[model samples]
Target: MSALFPTYKRFNLSVKQASGTTVEDTDGNTYLDFGAGIGVCNLGHRHPDVQLALENQLNQYWHVSNLYQQPIQEATAKWLIENSTGDQVFFCNSGTEANESAIKLARKATGKHKIISFKQSFHGRTFGSMAATGQEKIHTGFGPMLESFHYVPFNDRDAVKRAVDGDTAAIMMEMIQGEGGIHMADPDFVQEVAHVCRQNDVLLIIDEVQTGIGRTGKPFAYQHYDISPDIITSAKGLGGGVPIGAMMAKKTLRDAFGPGSHAATFGGNPLAMAAAQAVLKHVFQDDFLHGVTEKGRYLQERLNKSVGDLPVVSSIRGKGLMIGIECTEDVSHKISSLIDKGLLVLNAGPNVIRLLPPLIVSKQEIDVAVQLLSGVLTDEKASIT
Candidate 1:
């Protein structure tokens, strides 16, 4: 009997060990990992730098409550601020908490209540974040959602313009809808949203939980766009596999979140901070992100060549390492076929196959992924040999 809740559609394979882009099942089966723990393991499993940092921090005092004023937290926060528009940051244990914090802070800071989010956009699972999410299915069993959130179609400039009014506190969205089928926000649409926010005194919050921390070949996916967000919520790839989340905002709104306003017990654990510091070092490097961009182009090109014209495929989208292959039909069986062929990938929804390989994954590994996709779509044998 399983003690866990019947929540996730648990995969048959049990991961016993993982390294680089490879995962070994409990029964001694090996698979090339392309999901990267659903885009959390951006540096791949147990990256040497991140692993060493965690090990050293583990030897040190691992968990100290926020009262002690940890300098490691300052160091990590500075990295985020330096690379983005945020002047201050708050840490938490997961994306949900970070976003929840953002919602609270935005309303408190602006002294307004209503928030505008986009349809098909996912923020998180908490009540506040859930209320902000545009998908109706996520709110089905949760009973009446928290009030004062409005949803508009993604990339629809006029809907966003119409949604924002004097009562609206902020506008929250994702640069790429990672959970909503890997849809990228149009650059022009982003500019228009920012303009609307500026004119209406509305805070623009970008949820980077799945698209931040170099997931989109940039420090944050919003960096690719022309405008910057008033606040940013980040996680997933932040700690290189460790659980950590952050909500960053400009200095103008700093006073709103006065002491005792918001807090997380495990927010800045020494070990998670250590992991984040190590991750930031590599991600902020001169050519590290450039490499990811190159690899993304290569991966997309290969996918286009291999299965772009297949009858089952509809389109290939997303940027950086966060590519999605949209199919005309359900892709559950195709994903199972890839897993059987020793290539581990995941589905974004029912019909979109999402690929999020670790930034460190090489062209050869990408080739293996393409071969698996090709073989499965073509119904042929896919062999590493």
Candidate 2:
């Protein structure tokens, strides 16, 4: 009976409000949010700083075309470049657009038609991005996907070597495969990939949409690998809850995207820029990133100690707050039961329970979430027995 498209199999809860690490459903039920809006609200729901920035920007101006000079956009881009390996940036509205931009830029810069992406990698849903995504399930109905994209097995250095050819423009991958069951890329594999790209004169594009903006205990997850990517795509937590995405590139590739080469109407709008500026200002701090690293370690340790012995649990993996608990069976029922227990979670695939708590979540909240999760797993085990 709903007017909305049946795209998502939504939960029964109607969240009316949220703050920090909690959400209140219309029926007045409060749940500890471990999903953090699927890694989009890393600073937490309606963070005061981001909210204030939005309010101030609203009082000033919301939308402006790319024809004019926008100070806020410039400042946000500067912050992003200053904090990461990129020297220039292209602003967009979502991860898909950012990736789309990166793909086009790579092709233009190298004048190569083929792009090499890893299997189990997810770039985005747009035409170019969808083609870049390695999962066949996502491409099932979309026949005749865009051409010139080749997929190599993830974390397989030799396969990557085999996949790259003279026509290859770029090699794209996620530092941690969020949609692919929270799989972390092996450090050696990543280093080899960077080396391969360099040898082939192919650009290295890292999709940080799900793992960027402090989700992985670093300003950008690629920083952990110590490899320099020619381009990086980011979104998710960039604007806190507001929509914003960016495609950052090294100075060498910046000229490829001439003024008319790529553009987004609302890409660097004042509102999103304001929100992003606020988020960057807070998240780029040494203390903030250090806290994320500490919290990530804490969460992983707690999960290992509390549920490691559970018959249903296979492993707990990931970096920073983006942790996943691989279950022996589908976690749908367990997720639902946890929801009933006032805790919210997400699934990386069918069997992995993905937890993306906000960067600001307290240790107390983590303990509560873990305790609730333990209870749910225990009850499910009991039912099975």
lDDT assessment of candidate 2: 0.93
RMSD of 1: 2.6
How well does model 1 score by local distance difference test?
0.92
Q: Write candidate 1's Cα lDDT for 1-385 as tens digits.
A: 8999998997789989999899999999999999999999999999999999998988889887999889999999999999999999999999999999999999999899999999998998989999999999999987999999999999999999988889999999999998899999998999999999999999999999999988778899999997878899998899989999999999999999988999999998889999999999998875999999999999999999999988778899989999999987788988998999899898987899999999999999999899989889876222211
Off by over 4 Å in 2: none
Best by lDDT: 2
lDDT of 2 by residue, 242-340 (tens): 889999999998789987898898888799999999999999999999999999999999999999899889999999999999999999988999999
In candidate 2, residue 344 scores what lDDT?
Answer: 93
**Residue 98, model 2: Cα distance from true site in angstroms:** 0.5
Give the Å error, residue 370, model 1.
0.3
Give each model's whole-structure lDDT: 0.92, 0.93
Give one clash count per candidate, in the order shown.
0, 0
Instruction: Give the C-alpha miss distance for residue 299 in model 2, angstroms.
Output: 0.5
